[model samples]
Target: MTLQQAPETVRVTAAVEERMVTPSLSVQGVVSGAPTREVRFEGSAGGAKQIVTSVAVAQDASIAFGDLLATVSGVPVFLLPEGVPLYRDLRHGDSGPDVSAFQSLLTRLGYLRGSATGTVDARTLTATGLWYKAYGQKLPESEGKPYVAVDHFAAATGEGTVRLGPTVGQRLEPGKPLFVLSAGQQAVTARFTVPEADAVKVGTAVTVRASGGASFAGTIASIGPFQSNEASKEQRAGHDVRVELSLQDAAAPKEASTVSVTVGGQGRRGPAVPLSAIRQGSQGTYVTRELEGENSSGTPPTRDVTVAVLAQEGGWASIETNPELPPGAKVIVG
Candidate 1:
């Protein structure tokens, strides 16, 4: 005549709809760019001290072929394309790689026609004169013919844009850099642990968050070889590898800026439930799913459904089961 015991009730939560589950890793990095070359004052100031009379370009300004960079000692300094340094003066009869490079610059500036012949011929001389005249300066002459002098222009070793170095009224010396010329596209570089290096590959998608709260998409451009740090009294020994990222449809900050990079792995979409809802027993991993209607005893019927865990991230487990667990299905989590 003992009273019948009531079944213990369990709390339940709904299984989320199928969605993409992706593992992510965040790292700190800095915006960077390709190698930079120094723009120097290759011209001479007679025997007088070379002084920057005026500066036409601002710092971090983008310069192009035949653009006036500055004026030194009343002489204009023009920006030339990357090539062999303008060493000796070039006259109409000069013939060599330097002359060829100069001719190429003239052609790019629309001052010369056709291809560069690698010789300072009549076309080259006339182009040089027009180039100087365009910038409001008279072309230097040698033997009664216009010629290119070393000091009238500064040649960069690479191209793209430039970061100006010198300022107005600053004394300049021959061979000293007037600016730093950027050679290629800007990028971001980050150091990653050995495990991270192994997990990621080139072309992996990533999101970059700048220090100013701007976020943009990027991709893994390159990965450098691993490097081990030497043990020092001031630092612990460790190993890391460098990873470079290229921005998409955006430009990095002009100066090197700190950024947060979130690298995401491949994603898998499937039915997902709370990690706590997954139960493991001798029968294998399963979840206690509540059935549709209550039984005659007035209690909700439940069944343990076996599941194959596909992926688990952020306290959520993506699973596969024989009978599809549709979205909003109630599952016992507590």
Candidate 2:
């Protein structure tokens, strides 16, 4: 009774404030086509009827540039680069960006000489003649060369899978779709409810987590407006939206493949502390700041400060608090 209680002692572990933070939202998504193209055999049978006498590659075969896709009436139909899918034939006086591209590619392939003037002039025909000769075919007497046929041997700008639509004995029709070629390029798509849609926007940076722990970086390319799906009862009851993402990385997730997507908001730079320092209270979330004793000599007292948690990631959070936290400020984490 005579002895007074020693000065109250408070012992606790804590973390210090370091820097700012950005928050993230994780969602489920599927790998889908940025756009799957149907590769059609646009070659004319030269006004003579021809049947698909024989088949070459099997269904779903992975084809590459210069690979022989099939044999059409004893003539080799090969997979070439993407540029050959021209809608109309390329001829002199037909000047456009497409012609320029064709000219450039022909020059690079050593099939043509002179600059790519963007106009299909005499040089284009010279290049065309050389290409036809190399491919064992003579230049057509027709005014325009079959640009689509040239695609048969032009370098494949995009690699794709073989989707054969025509079979042996099938009659070829002028301008009708033949076999389809899939480029196999893909993007990621995420679904969300009306409420969640408000938080997401195009141009938001995102990371897709693939199977086996692989992660790829991308950006939100589009956000679809809310629409009802009459096919599903649940979907019909709530507004649903789609978010399309464009991958910055080369490797694309397989078709119909599922992956995890982490969407992050525009990053902000500021002071941050360990997540443990944040506490949920009756009022809201808050953190305890340690105050220095007289002359900064002894154990310090602590005061609770209200804070608005903006974002939390990587074990830290970006917060809005009064009298912004100073570097090295001690905070009670536990």
Candidate 3:
């Protein structure tokens, strides 16, 4: 609208500013494994339920070659990123959640018992033994102190004990669990090593190219404070950065579900505009300016200013102001 119709208190003007443009990179990543089948057994009578575990299907969700399988109650199990894929020989157990965290899930889900510290500890083993006993099978004592037999987890804690009957201590409510178990679910973010020429800071925005038929959007979650080139050439000069994409609301079909990930940091800087003159709107922004004399044009004269925001506090945008534009400039906003 023209400025003539603008209210007397309205300010307006055309704004010029800067915005950073980011480069896009292509990456190869995967969709963490999913449960194929679930086998659950009920105890014939006391004796503890024989909850032999295996996946309805078998998935070697192991990221490392020697990495062990994640299982519980005959359910082909889950995992988490054991380590940096590059350094750890490109393992994918870290489908999205942490496997160590899953050990805990098994305990809480009543599927397997014990502490879920990501490792197969005595608590986990004891829980397993109790589960086996419920199925009429006798489980030998664990090799360690409370007798832990789950060898995968060497760092066990507390003397693991079997809670044969329904957890005896107290009645617990569902949804209001005493502890949380990791489901092995994780949001995939693109990671890249920056060179001296491309080193970027944390919180930087990145424009991710949707490849492998999957479209995901996100920002720079972390830029390693320290630099390491032990993995990729890009790390030689710059640090390794992780970019996260919140796929919570993204529309992705199953076909591209497990697509590879590639990422690039927002190469350009954020928007830079003078906060003083901008009038925010529900959908967009407009500049309101006072009419020259009371008999000006009813339409607001707008510059269609490019808004590149840097920092804004209070009511002002820490931006470069237009010299020709006067202060208290009011424009017609309709």
Number of clashes found in candidate 1: 1
Show where candidate 3 strays beyond 4 Å: 1-45, 48-201, 204-211, 228-236, 248-334
Q: Best by lDDT, which number? A: 1
lDDT (Cα, tens digit) per residue for candidate 3, span 239-327: 34555554432243232344444435334543333445554443334344444443355654444332323344333333334443344
Which regions of candidate 2 are displaced past 4 Å?
1-25, 38-49, 52-71, 76-110, 114-126, 136-176, 179-184, 191-258, 263-270, 273-311, 314-316, 319-334
Provide the overall lDDT of each model, using Cα atoms, as 2-decimal numbers: 0.71, 0.62, 0.36
Please report how far candidate 2 places residue 240 from its true position, in Å: 12
Highest TM-score scorer: 1
- Listing every candidate in turn, what is its Cα RMSD in Å to the true structure after a full C-alpha superposition? 10.8, 11.9, 19.2
In model 1, what lDDT does residue 249 have?
A: 27
- TM per prediction: 0.58, 0.41, 0.25
Q: Which residue runs of candidate 1 sit more than 4 Å off their true CA positions?
A: 1-20, 30-34, 92-101, 114-120, 141-145, 185-187, 191-201, 209-218, 224-259, 264-267, 270-312, 315-334
At residue 202, give the lDDT of candidate 1: 76
Candidate 1's TM-score? 0.58
lDDT digits (tens) for residues 1-334 of candidate 2: 5988889756564545545566676767888754545545655436656567666666667765545555565555655556644445666678777777777767767878778787778767877767666656555545454332442332345656655456888887766655565664356767654323444566767788888687877767767755656767644322233345444233656668888888677676666667678765555567888777833446677788767666666777676544746666778875
